[model samples]
Each structure stands twice: as structure tokens, then as C-alpha cells.
Target: MLNRRQLITSLALSATVLALPAPGLAQPAPTTRIVVPFAAGGPIDVTARILAEAVKGTLGTVIVENRPGAGGNIGVGAVAKAAPDGLTLGIATTASHGINPWLFSKLPYDPAKDFAAVTQMLRVPNVLVMNADAAQRLNINSLADLITYAKANPAKLNYGSGGTGSAGHLAGEMFKNQAGIFALHIPYNGGNPAQLGLLSGQVDFNFDNLATAAPNIRSGKLKALAVTTTQRAAAMPDVPAISDTLPGFEIDTWWGLVVPAGTPVETVRKLNAAFTEALRSPEVKARFATLMAEPAPSTPEQFDAFMARERTKYERVVKLSGAKVD
Candidate 1:
């Protein structure tokens, strides 16, 4: 019923109002991706999923994607090449960040240069476990006993590890150097095989992840000599640390959150805040306990420094062990 001019004016005002966003309403956040460089259901993937859930309130919508391959190079490389908008992040690990730089001659991504460390998520201590029967047969009841036996026997005592350049292999190399014992190195296809070999007495001992070795240790199939962490693991408080006898001897699996290097400092700080908060939560603590992992959240500066030290340590171990993937 209005005149043409009035109708036009009303229509224009209505369009303008529709175009403006509501005063208090916020736009939906884009989904953030945590690229886990491992297969689904593995420890790293599980950790990423847990973190994704923990940070949901702060990060809005976060998802975990598994892009495992090439000893985590493919997935990590994907993160390295991703747009530095903080939308894509990575779960960088000891393997990807610490050892791979030296192990793989032609690494797909530069661990130090391509990513900004947000915070260290957790550490999974590796235990030196001997087959129960072998331990009993050799009279090796503790780390001291094993080191003494190896020193006396020299190259006669053999240890199995997850391939030549694996974390286990590097840990073994460090152990030999620190303990001054000579044990033959037997490389297996992977961790499972290495553990299997140790269980069957194919090898005398193994530097195995605490989570996978805990059940066997409880069942008396494997005798835990010591954890490789500087301190004893919470899940197995009775066990001693290798560092207890060989001070400065520390080799453990660890992982943390990282974003592309070019991401703005503001975005990096925001991510670090969210992830460190999640790592400090009691729910995350309990969940990590179930995995036999210890949360080790740290500031961006601390994480970068930690990674630098880790890489330097691995450089020595890898060279001494002569481990190569090229």
C-alpha cells in the first residue's frame, strides 16, 4: 500500500539490516586439523584425538587426521607445506623431530626450520626389558647385572631393536656407550617383532616402550631392568632408571604440537595456550596415565630448546650406531 519511493526505502533498509551480523553472535570457527604422522589407533593418534577433544571448548572444532608413511615424513611434510594460518598443525615426535633429521639423509621436511614448536605433549619412557627366562638363566636381575654380564660377555650378549635407525636402536647405542658394554645389535622389522624376538629369547634384551612391555612385565614374561627416562616411570614406580646407574643417560619417546613456521606469532601463542591448558587438565592427566605417558607441557621457547638438545643427542647416537635410512 506504500508509495514507490517509500517501498524502495523500506526495502533498502531491510537489506542493510539483513547484511549486518547480529551484535553478540559470533561466526563459526573453521575446523582445525591435527595431522598425526602415524596410523590410526597408535599412541600418537590416540593422543591427538584426546587433545582434539580437550581443546574443543577453546579451539571450537578440531579434528585429527592420520597421514602415516615414510617414517612419519609424509604426514609431517604435509604439515610443513600447509598454509601457515594455524589451521593445520602437527604432532611432532622424537622420531620425526629428533632422530629423523640424522637417520634419514634426505628428510622430506626440516624439523627445526619448518615448524614452530607449540608445546611438548608427553613423554613415553622406554624400558630395558629382558626375557624372563633369559634373565633367570643369565642371573641378570637388574640393570647393573645386565651391564656387568654384557661387559663380561662382550659381543656375546645381543639386543634386538626396531630396525637400524629406530629410536630403540639409538637408545641401545646410547646404553652401550654409557654402560661401556658391547652387545650385538639385531634389527627387526619393527617394535612388535623386536619384542617378539626378546620374548622368544632370540635376543637377550630390548629397549622397549613401557606401555607395550608393561603387560608382559606384569605377567613375568619380561624382566624390566630399568626405564630409559631420567626418572622412574609413574606406571612402574618400582623399576629403576638407567640414568640411576649411568648418569646423563636419557632416551625416551616424546611428542608435541607444532604449526608451520610462517604462522603469525599471535596464532602460535594462542595455540600454545590452548594445548598447554589441555595438557595440564586432570582429565588429560588421567587419560595419559592410562597410556603410561607423562604430560610434559612446556612453553614455545622451552620446547624449541628441548628439541635442539634432542637432535644434538641423536646426532651423536646415530653416528656412533651407524644407523642410516638413505
Candidate 2:
């Protein structure tokens, strides 16, 4: 359990970590692995890699292993079932850490009780886009146009989601629920494949992160429709926000670090310090700037609170979306 004092304390909590007897805790050559729940090249993996490299000097030899599957539940479940040792950590993302709890009827791991929060890393807004040619044909230059089209041709229009219970999927579902529209959903193996489906004309639209869609949008392969964030992102200032079309429609993905539940209190403190320090580094900040995501460092307590709020928010969205694991 997190104490208010511990949550509000801004001091480097890592210094207080007890040096548990790991294989190389004393040696300078210890290795640590950070498991990313999503596939490589996504925001979660990208941020984990960047932070891992930045903290390698302080946290020993850092490595990232991708175990993407089941809308990120498989990788996250791995962390949940892993030993509560300091060596095995996980990159917690919105789909895995936040939304899945509400979406899945029987999750292998409890999002609130089965993991230890380390530090909050970054928050990214999702981009809504369509293939350029499709955009031109539909004349759907804005979010308003898309909504109108969906309303006019409910069953004919559809959107792509990373998977049945993924963040992008839920964001689209939430949009449909809020706007009173019905768009067919086409789930893919991952965001990359979902984006590909949209690009190849297999799907009409996709809601994904700016980092994933930026290149396509810039190259005129995909046209930017709107961002799921309430405010316009610095990376795409000219694009309108989903909130602009439907008020109170904000659904951004947040990422963080966590360990298996029951990790020694001291180890959690040490890991938090390494992550917080990593977030403050110039290199990590530069990477976040490029991704159009902001690094948000928080105490273990604050991370816990953030996850709680996310759990509540996504529960409503999930129930509305009628999501379930297969």
C-alpha cells in the first residue's frame, strides 16, 4: 500500500532502496530486463528502449524484450506472474495497464492489485486518419464530415482498431458511443497492421498514435482527421481535436513502469529512482519531443493514483464498447 507521504514526496526515492541479494547487486555488471507489452516500434516499446538506454548507467545493463499479444495482455501477464525480483520489470501501457481491466471479463492479472507501480513515463494522444485517396473520395476532410458520413451510412462506414480491446479500438468505440453513431470495427494483429489495413483500402479509418501515423500523414499516404486529445498536439497543430467535434471526448494513452506485485519495498524505490532519473535526461526528453508525447515523472503513489483514475475512466468505455477477450 502507498502512503500519502510517500506519494507526495518529491525526493529521489531510489536512494532508500534496500540492496536485496540479487545475482550481481554488488557487482557493477548486473543485467535488468524491461518487458514491453506492445510490439517494437510502437510508443510503449520506443519509450521503454529510450528510457532503458538512459538508465543503463544507473540501473545496470538494461534490456527490452517485446512480448506483444492479446492487446498487450500477454506481455503484461508475464510481468504479473514473474518473480517480484528487481531484475524483471515491465513497460505498462494504456492498453495493458489501464483499459484491459474493464474490457476483459477474466483477466489473468489484476491491474490494480497484481503489479507494483514504479513511475509514470509518458502520455500520447491518438491520431484519427484515413488513406489519402479515401479521404478525397469521401470528402471527409474533418471530424465533422466523418461523423456526418457515418450517420448517413451507418453500416457502410467502418474503422480499424489494433485489436478488440486495444486503446485505439476503445477510443473509436468511445467516439461512436458518445456521438451516437455506429461504425463497423475491424480489429488487426497490431497497430501497424491496422494502419496498413487503412492504407490499403481494407479499412476506412484508424485511430492510432501520432508517432505511428506521422510518417504516413506527412507522406500523403494517410490524411490526418483529428486527434483524440482535447488540445491540439504540437506535432500536428493544424489538425482539429476530437473534442472539437464531440465535447468531452478525450482518450489518450499513458505509459509507465511497473514490477510484479510484492516486489520488495526497497527494490521498488530503487527502480522508481532509475525511471525518474531517466525521464529527466536530455536524450529521453528529445525522443519524447519527436514523438509528440510528454514525459510525466511521478512518485510510486502518484502512479498508483493515475492508474486508479484510468481504471475508472476505461470501465465506462469498455462497458459501452462491449469488448471481450477471445
**Residue clash pairs of candidate 1:** none
Please report the candidate that would top lDDT against the real structure. 1
lDDT of 1 by residue, 57-134 (tens): 999999999999999999999999999999999988999999999988898799989999899999999999999999
Q: For each candidate, what is the lDDT? A: 0.94, 0.86
Candidate 2 lDDT over 1-326, as tens digits, reads 66888865634455444444566456566689999987898667878889888998788799999998876789989999999988999877777767877777777788889899999998887888988898899888888888898899869888998788788888888988888899899999877899889999999898988888899999999999899989998788999898988998889978898999999999999999988988988888888889888889999999989889888888888888888764
Q: Top model by TM-score, which number?
A: 1
Error of 2 at 143 (Å): 1.4
The C-alpha stretches of model 2 lying farther than 4 A from their native spots are: 1-29, 38-42
